[model samples]
Structure formats: C-alpha cells, structure tokens
Target: MSVAARIAGPDLHETSVAPRSRSRMLALVIALAFAAVGGQLVRLAWQNEDASTIRVSMMSSPANTLARPDIVDRNGRLLATDVQMPSLYADPLLIQDADEAAERLVRLFPQIDVRELRQSLADKSRRFVWVRRGLSPAMAQRVHNLGIPGLLFVDEIRRTYPAGRLGGHILGRVDIDNRGTGGIERYIDEIGASEAAVGARLSARAPVRLSLDLGVMHALDEELAGAMVRYEAAGAAGLVMDVLTGEVVASVSRPGVDPAVYEDALDPSRIDRIAAGTYELGSIMKLVTVAMALEMGRSLDSMVDTAEPLKAGRFTIEDLHPLGRPMSVSEVFIHSSNVGAGQLALSAGAATQKAFLQKLGLWSALKTEVSSGPAPQKPQQIGRIEQITLSFGHGLATTPLQFAAASAALMNGGTRVTPTFMALDGEAPVVRGERVVSARTSALLREVMRRNVTDPAGTGRRADVPGFEVGGKTGTAEMAAKGGYRKKSVLASFIGTFPSSEPRYVTLILLFEPKGQDVTGGEITAGRNAAPTTARIIERIAPLLGVPAKSL
Candidate 1:
C-alpha cells in the first residue's frame, strides 16, 4: 500500500473512536444529573414528612393557657394579673447523656425529680419534655448558666396575685398552664371573660371590676387575723355586704389560701367559710323565725311562752339562760330563747315555715360569682320535730353567705337581694328580684335587731359600736362531730347590720372552736367572741365603705 493511503486510514479510525468517546461521556453526564435531581427530591420529601410529624405531635399535645383580664377591686386596684415568665423545656433527642443532663438539672432545681427527668431525657423518641414551668427571672438565669445543650426557654404568661393571701378565696387559683381552677377565676372563664392564649399574648379586654373594696378587705383581714389569735380559735371567717345592692364589700376566710401556692386551696381546713361551708348557726336562725312571725302579722311586743323546754322526737331544746317567764317576741330575740323561737316556728306551720325560708333563698342552693354555694341541708321531712329543731338552727345547715343574703332581704326594705361579687355598673340595667317580705315586716325586723344590740340585757350588746348604729344577733352552736354534736366545740357567730335605721350593709363574723380566754371572761359564747369581732370590723370598714358615723 502507498504511505499516504495508510496515514489517511489511521486518521479516519482515530476520528471514529473520538466521536464515540464524546457521545458516551455526554450520556454519562446526563445520567448523573438525573440521579442528583432524584436524590434531591427524596431528601426534600423526607424533610417535609419529618416536619409534618413534629407539627402533628405539637397539635395533639394541647398547651392549655388562658389570657385573662386583670382582676381589680372596685377602686381599680389590681388583685390578679398575668406576667411574663420563662418556661423551660428540653429536646430529649438532642441530649447526649441523659444521666448527666438530669443530674445537672436536679442540682439547679432540687424540686425536680432526678429519676423522672433522666428517664424522660433517655427517651430519644421524644423530641420535647418540660423541665420547669413558671421560672422566676433569677431561676431562669441560673438554669441558663448551666449551658445544657438541649435545654431551652420560651416566654409564657403566668398568673400572679399581687395581694398575696389577701382575699385569696375570692380571687381563687390557676393551674400550671394558667387556666383558672376555682372561685372568681373559674367564673371569669365560665362567663367568657377570658380568652385562650397562644404564646405570651396578653388580654386586651377591660379589667374585671369586683364589688370588693380593697381597703375594706384589707381591714377585715387584719381584724380577723387578730381575732383568730386573740380568741385562740381554730378558724375564723368574716364578710361585709351591701344590703340594698347585694354587693360583697369584703370577705375573708382564715387560714386563707395563697393564690400563688395552688396546694393551699385544696386543703379542707382552708376552705372558704363564707360560701363553701354549711353550719347550723344556732340563734342566728332566730332571725328567720322572728321575721316569719312578723310576716304573719305578729307584733314585736307579741308574747310567747319560753319558760318550758321545747320537746321534739328524742330531743329537747333548752336555752342556755332561760328567762323562766314568758318572753315577748323582741325579748326572745334579745335573750336568744330557743324555746320561744320553736314556739314561733310551730305557730307558722311546717309548710309555712319551709315556704318562708325558701322565699328568703335559704332552703335551697345559691349561686354567686364565686361559686355555686353548697345546697343547704334540710330535714327530709319537715315534721313537727324537724320544724322545732330548725327554728333555732339545730337541724338545718346553711352557708353564712346564703343566710346573710336572706338577712339583707329583711333589712333592705323587704326586697330580695342576690349577692354578687362583680361590681355593679351604674350604667348597666339592673333586674331587681321579687320582694320577699312586706316593707312593714322588714321595718319591724330592723327595729327588733337594733333592740337586740342596744338593750342592756341583749346578747349582742357587745357588738354595738358607737355612732355606727351596729345591730346584730349572737349565735353559739355546738359543732356536729362524727355522729352527734360536740358540746364543748362550739361555733360562735354574729350577724350584724350597721345603721339599722337605713340598713345599708350586713356583716357576719364567725369563730370556730374559740377557747375561753381572760378577755372573754371564760365564756365561749358568740357574745364574748364574735360580737366584739363584729364591732371592730364594723368600725374600721364602715369609714372605708363611705358609711358616715351618726350621733348616738
């Protein structure tokens, strides 16, 4: 072959190999590009699924929180408010060593259970776990200094009671997530006065104005605390309410619960005495009997034979200080004669007596802004024996709040008064309740109540405060125990009305298991304990309540 032909053939063979190599390299590059695109799509889909799972878990674990408006007294003083606090959480999956994490956390917060925390952290499946909630600024700072990798903090709204233990029963308590559990706090939720919160959002609604006068409440609390110490009592409760408007001015129950410490509220001894507890309040029931008598057209001077002990089925009711002579209706109240009250109750038949009490809202359950007061326990059958026993408050049990409202009806010119914790808005329309008694009967009842305080022989004379026109009735009821009444453990109470001529407010003071002291002349009667307490309370709160002192 010629040399030129051989060279051209070699060059053509090299050209064909170069074109095939270029085609193969192009296809390989395209295939790699398609593979990269597919990998990116798969990674994105996995990430999205993971995010969706987290979102679903978050939604399912409901974070219960409430955005509540400020609770203020009638004077616009803040009682309860929401404050921002740091809440701690941890990413369990991110924790490298759960034992070390839990140990460090427990050192910072001794209250934390180390074992539970360690178990929670070891659960790598769990992404989140609550470490602590409602941490104070100082506490949160200490936790931050720990430098734990998985630990984190989020701002949360927390309930704070500025008044501490003052009016605790009225203000009530909230849960860890800030949802109200009881008292006025729960009422706020029930009435739609609060909103669900997301994050640290605050309520934009107007503050809830309560009928409570902060000044009055503080004074009442101070006085009741002093009384508890002075009388050596197990517990004490007191309340002041507007007779005409039925607005609770001040109320206190001791051993008061601190709203900040939620556990204190659950204690049985710390229960709200003014509304939550029922007691057979002894001679205080005489107020209802006397009112019933007056409603039946009996005059204050009407006489009833209280010389003999009242007999019931296997029971005998006798006065502590029997007059031995017949007592006039007014004298019976002044002397607190249980037999006379029984006679009066019998005069008004069982049906009429029950009907009268029901009319006064004392024979059934009562609901206020604070709570649905326990239903009054009455005899299943209002037989002759039951009627006689109920006349002097031995067989019937009612809350002081219910009885106070009923008494207010008798003093507020016979209008039915429904007690309220919310402040009444003057601009808002008021739906007045039905009248419970004749105005004439109410007038006579007021006169008798005043006489019970002013007369020298009256059991409530100690309750009379100078210039305040304080008029009240004393009650000393034996406390009921496991099966029967404990004679020595008496509940002393005073139901008082100030400026009896006008009767603007009613105050009730109670001392449970008060001991006889030198100041009380070794007497456990309400006249020695609760009556004086009422006088002190009235003198201090009347001025704050805008009740002017009158000339004697």
Candidate 2:
C-alpha cells in the first residue's frame, strides 16, 4: 500500500467516529434535563391544585352586614368580637349517599336532628344545603373525621359577644351571614364594610372602639339587673354619657339579647329601650321647661303658684305631690310640679317654647342614626295646646336618647352636641354645637336640678349621691295608648348630672310598666324607680369617670 493513502484513510475514519460519539452524549444530557423539568412542573401543579385546596366563602347578606365591628371598652377589654367558625354544608349533587351522610353527621353532632338532616339532604333538587352554622372547632373536627365525601366544611364568621347578654342592647347583634342588624353592629356595618370588601382580608381593620367603658358597663348592668330583681320591675333601662363630649360611657337595657344566639331571645321587649322606644317622659320635662324659662330671662327665684291645680281647657294640672303653695322656680323643680312647668311653658309662648326645644334638639328625632325610636313631635304645628303639653313632657314622645341629649345640652353650658356612638379621639374633637340656652341660664338650671336631687326634701331625694353632688329631675308619666292613658302603667324616668357646680356627666334611667308594690310605696313613680337606679349607677360609675367626691 502507498503510505500517503493509508494515513489519510485512518485520519478520516477517526474524525467521523468522534463527531458521532459527541452528538449522542449531548442528546442524552438534553433528554434527562427535559424530564427533570417536566417532573417538577407536574409535581407543583398537583400540590397546588389538590381537591382539598379550594377555599370557598358564602355571600354576605344585607341583614347580616349590620353586625357591628368588634366593640371594645375604653380600656381595650374585648366587649364584643367576631369568632371564627366552621359550618357544615352539603352539595346535594355530590352527595350520593344522603341518608348515610345525614345519619353519620347527626350521630356525631347530637344537637342535629338526624331525621331532618336526612330529609334536607334527600332533597336533591336543592344543590346546596346547610347542615348547620356556628359549629365549634371540636365539633368541626368530629365532622371532618366522618370523612364523607359529599359533605363539605365551610368557614364562617359569627359574632361572639363575650360579655354574653351584657351590653347586648348597645352592641346589638348580627344576622347569620355576619352583617350587623342592630345596635353598634348595625351602626358599624352601615359605615365599616366598604374597605373590608376588598381582597385584603388580612388587612381588615379591628372592630370599632365605643365610647363605652366595659367596667362601667359591667357595673351598670349589675346594678340594673339587681334593680330588676329587687323591684320586680317588668324591665329596666339605664345609660350614662359625658355631657361635654357626648360619649356614652355606660348603657344598660334589661332583657338584652345574647349576641352568641339572638334567635332564642324571644321577648322583643329586650330591644334598646333607650334608642328605639318612645315614652311620655313626665317631670323630666321640668328640665326642658326650666331651661326654657331661664333662657327667656326668667330667674331661679321666679315664682309660680302651685298651691292648687292650673285649669287648662278641660285639663287640670297638679303636682303629683302637691306643694300646697306658691313655688319659686327652684321650688318648682324640687317639687316637680306640673302646674308650675305648664305655667312656664304657657308664659314662654308657643313660638318661644318650640324654639327652645328645637334648639335643644328635642323637636326632631335625636341625631343618632342608630336610633329607631319615634321622632319627637314638633309642637303639633307650634301652638298653645302642644306647647303647654310638651312643657311637662306630654303630648310629645321622645326616645330616652333624645331626653339624654337635651339634658346634656342643658347642663353642658347650653350647647347641644348631637350624641355620638363613635369613639372619641385621644382628645375629643371640638365641634361647634347649637346653643340652646345662654351660659348663665344653663348654670342656673344646673343649680336647680342639683337641689332637686341632692336636697333632703327634694322630690328626687332617692337620686341623691352624698359626695358626687347629684343633680337631676324626676318624671313619672302615665303611659298613653290608643284607647287612653294606660290606667296603671307608667314610664318612670330620672334625667340628671353630677358635681352640679361644674357638670361633667349626664345620666338617665327609665322603667317601663313597673308593677306597683309595697317596696315602691304604691307610688310606682320615677322618683321611686328611675331615681334610685340613676343614683346607684352614679355611685358605681363616678370613679370610672374620674369624678371626685365633693370637698367637705
């Protein structure tokens, strides 16, 4: 063989073999890498898309939206909260064995009616069915252990009022879908939900802070509850407010609902008597009349004849407990004389009386949107009959909140600050309010009211607090129904303030349909029921409000 030919042939063959070997190695590595990547993608998709991975939420109902944000007392104690709950539901379509699922569920949750559950699940026409709402974690765990495929577990938010029935009327309750229906809940739902509806669920703000103090609320609730027991009263309601700031520090309405379960709260009467109910608050009118007369240039020394009844049309106005003689403006308040208050209203004239009340925010419903009470009548077209009757808190029905706000105005330098449910800022915001009386007149009225409650001989002696310098007026009005005045039923109310010289807080307590008893001296009047309750509340709440005992 020729040497050149042999060298060329060998070199060419070696180069071809090396090219083929390198191509095979590259292809093998590329294939292995592609397989690893594909496996990772599949594993990720399976992990994220598992059947149990889906989370669902039920729609919120309008009625349920009224459920208020959490309500916290001033000290940050939880008065109310929204508890996380697990609910049992069924996809009838998925439930192949309805009878088995229902039986198993009922066996686990004894509270559930097995027969009813079976019937409900058997109704296949209904795609979605609720087994129950508000299940506990333990209950949820048991239900999960059943492991029945078609039965589903859904998470729900239910309102939990830890205070139980305490402050129920004030905090209110929500509907099943977690919307606020009444009380603070209703107020917050109306104002608190827009931002929460976004996807930022974790960013959802906390429940609202109320002007209420939980400690104060607890004390008031206890005192009123005791009164209900002691007086054998049909029901009782009480409230306290910062006169200068319009903050409700404590409120109680007996027969309140348990937010945890409102459906079973059968007695509809447990609704807020202070905000939704109306009353012909009687001598409580004296507070208005006194403020009216003083603003019209009448002095505390101004005298009115109260020895006998005042004849008006067919009506004769007399003090419940007659003074038996002329009464000074101060004496009129102390005696709680209807004759004297009527005279003041008449002398002030309808226009002036109406104007005074309108300024005091009494001519209209109280400005609180949380209210459901009837609006106060505006002097029935502003005339004499209406004015005279309104003077004694008759012929006009106002919610207790209206009476409280007006009384606060009378004591807070005559400036009517619309009552507020929102928490006050660290320092209260200064709002220019309507002036109902001159500063001097308001001062004089405060003095008169003080003497009425604190004076030993005053009609409201029961309302007196030894060192707190209690000042208030009593009202015992006959309850008027469509037929006529309820012969035996009365609305007993006491409206007043404390440290009368420099007023800080205003409070009121009311009793509805209190039965006459020996303990009440057969009077069944506000002086007997509402007055004493108000006194008890002040005695307990004074320290909370930072009200010092009067200096000796």
Among the numbered candidates, top lDDT falls to: 1
lDDT of 1 by residue, 1-552 (tens): 234544566575566566577678789999999999999999998799788977865763345588999999999999999998989999987889999989999998999999999999999999989999999999999988988888988888899999889889988888887788888999999999999876777789899999999899989898988998999999999989999889999999999999999689879999999999998988898999999999998999989998899888788888888879998999988999989999999999999999998999988999998897899888899988888878888888999999999999999889999999999986777566799999999899889889988899898999988998888899999999999999889999999998999989999999999999999999999999999999999999888888899976
Model 2 regions lying over 4 Å from their true place: 1-69, 91-97, 107-116, 123-128, 145-149, 193-203, 264-267, 377-384
- In the range 39-149, model 2's lDDT, one tens digit per residue, is 999988887755343332323321223223557877687887766677788988888898889888878778888888898888878877889887899988888888887
User: What C-alpha lDDT, on a 0 to 100 scale, does residue 2 get in candidate 2?
Assistant: 32
Give stretches of model 1 more than 4 Å off: 1-64, 427-431
User: How well does candidate 2 score on lDDT at residue 276?
Assistant: 73
Total clashing pairs in model 2: 13
**Clashing residue pairs in candidate 1 (N, C-alpha, C atoms within 3 angstroms):** none
Model 2, TM vs. native: 0.82
Highest TM-score model number? 1
TM-scores of all predicted structures:
0.87, 0.82
